[model samples]
Target: MTVSAPPAPPAAQRTPPAPAAPRRRRPIAPYLMVAPLVLVLAGVLLVPLVRLIVVSFQKYGLDQLVGGRPSEWVGLDNYGEVLAAEEFWSSLWHTVRFLVIAVGLTIGLGLLLAHLLAKVSRSVRVIMLLAMVMVWAMPPIIAMPMWRWLIDQRFGVLNYTLFHAGVLPTRSFNWFSSPVTGWTVICAIVVWGALPFVVISLHAALTAVPGELVEAARLDGAGAWRVFTAVTFPAIKPTVLIITVLSIIWDYRVFAQIWLLRDIGANKDTYYTIGIWSYVESFSNKNFGLGAAISLISVVLLGAFSIFAVRSVLRTAQAADAEADAR
Candidate 1:
């Protein structure tokens, strides 16, 4: 062009992202909003906890309670007795065993169901979700009774079906005759009740996994288990860990199922777990101090376990984060 094209004016200076709108100041409103809940928890949980520890050191039996006399401070006697008692140790053993079985089955079955849900069509998923929700919504109070009926010696559907199917030798099997069989049924119910929650939680976690990652793994010829362990599980590891911790805590404190079954004449002493032992000691045995001691011990043990669990969760999360950043 004859006259070198008029020089283009320099572009206007770009705004520097408005200084990133200044880092947001976290508002105090949220803290204030939760203050009421904190107070309520203090009143309900903290007050009872303090009372429990105080009573644990004293002989707080029904005699003292009814006689209007101050409790005798027994110091370490309750702890020594509890530690030496065979009943306490037996209860602990049963509790630990049941905890392992229930939590394991619940987590395993739940994980399987969650993956199945992911692969199912929308209608199938909806139906499965509705079924789980129904089961989950049923209170243990109601659910236990239903389960008891199913396993009842006389009119139990379980016995009828098993007898017909030749799975059981007799038409009426005494499920509660031995600790092993009784516990098997009890564990089944516990696992059943616990599965819905686990499945739902895991499904939610699974839903968050990136489709691209899954597809890439498949494209690279990873089989189902390989894909799960490599691409899918790593993504949901934090959720799984957290759920496992929760399952441990909840399963450790199981009481209602055993109590209801016992109340209906399931068995005596055979089915006693730690929670049942605590209740029996407190009310039935009228040894409140011992019960308090047991509860305090349980609280301490649980706290220790919770600490370990929290550490695991944190460690895993940190590891995952580092791996992600490395990528």
Candidate 2:
């Protein structure tokens, strides 16, 4: 009788869980919001880039394009022709030189300006920022002509003023006559044109530095210079690298300054960047294939730089994650 009672008590049933209501999918509202931007980018940027890449491999001449002969594929022959040409190599070297000088000048001056402006009062900082913006907003063409005029030999205001002040030996110092002098002047103009953007970007980055972090460094016995080198430098380094890379790219493709100077009777041979060489190949020599090849080489060089940039970003991200984990 006791065994039968225990067995009856052990037969209690377990309840099953209630089925979960099917999760309503999240509304696609955010993606829909970005659709306009996606469309704009595809239309304005991506389509053009794809077209350019396709046209680059084709043997299309100005005449062929106009007459509608239809461009035929030429494979790597165009690239071989570009590589075999002396002018292409020389132009590439010139571009490399310009990039080195321009990037150095831009980053060095920009960092100095950013550091100085970062320490200024709020109102003064705003004024400085506005001034930088004004320069940045001005077109390159505007500044190019002005620089050309200022450096002109005969009937130039800068030379006239210098001669009146007895600073220069003669009233007509040829600024763009000599190849060496012309290149120097062109590089100076390019650096000046690029400086404002560098200054503003780095200034913004510097201003974003955390005061608490800076104070902590000071508490740990770091001096102004030490704190800047150790803390501020590290914090703004990513922005600095980004700006430097952009400057490198811009400087590498500099054509207007060189062209303007050349038009002003300066030696076109003074500074022939890859851009100028490509232009000459296409329009001057009517060799579209060689021009396309030169452009592709330029693309490869820039691509290499981009690869380096990506690696740098990835390394920095990994280091940051490691540091966070350690903390």
lDDT by residue (tens digit), candidate 2, 72-151: 89887788778887887787778787788778988998899888887789899899888878878888888877876787
Q: For every model shown, what is its TM-score relative to the native structure?
A: 0.88, 0.82
lDDT of 1 by residue, 1-327 (tens): 587887765667544444556778899999999999999999999999999999899999998879888899999999999999998899888888998989999999999999999989999999999999998898888888788889988899999999999998998788888788888888998888888889999999999998999899999999999999999999999999999899999888888888888654556897887788888999998999999999988888889999999999999999999998998
* Deviation of model 2 at 8, angstroms: 15
Worst 10 residues of 1 by lDDT: 13-22
Q: Ten consecutive residues with minimal summed lDDT in candidate 2?
A: 3-12
Candidate 1 structure, TM-score to reference = 0.88
Please list all clashing residue pairs in model 1, or write none if there are none.
Answer: none
Q: All predictions: root-mean-square deviation over Cα?
A: 8.4, 4.2
Name the best candidate (by lDDT).
Answer: 1
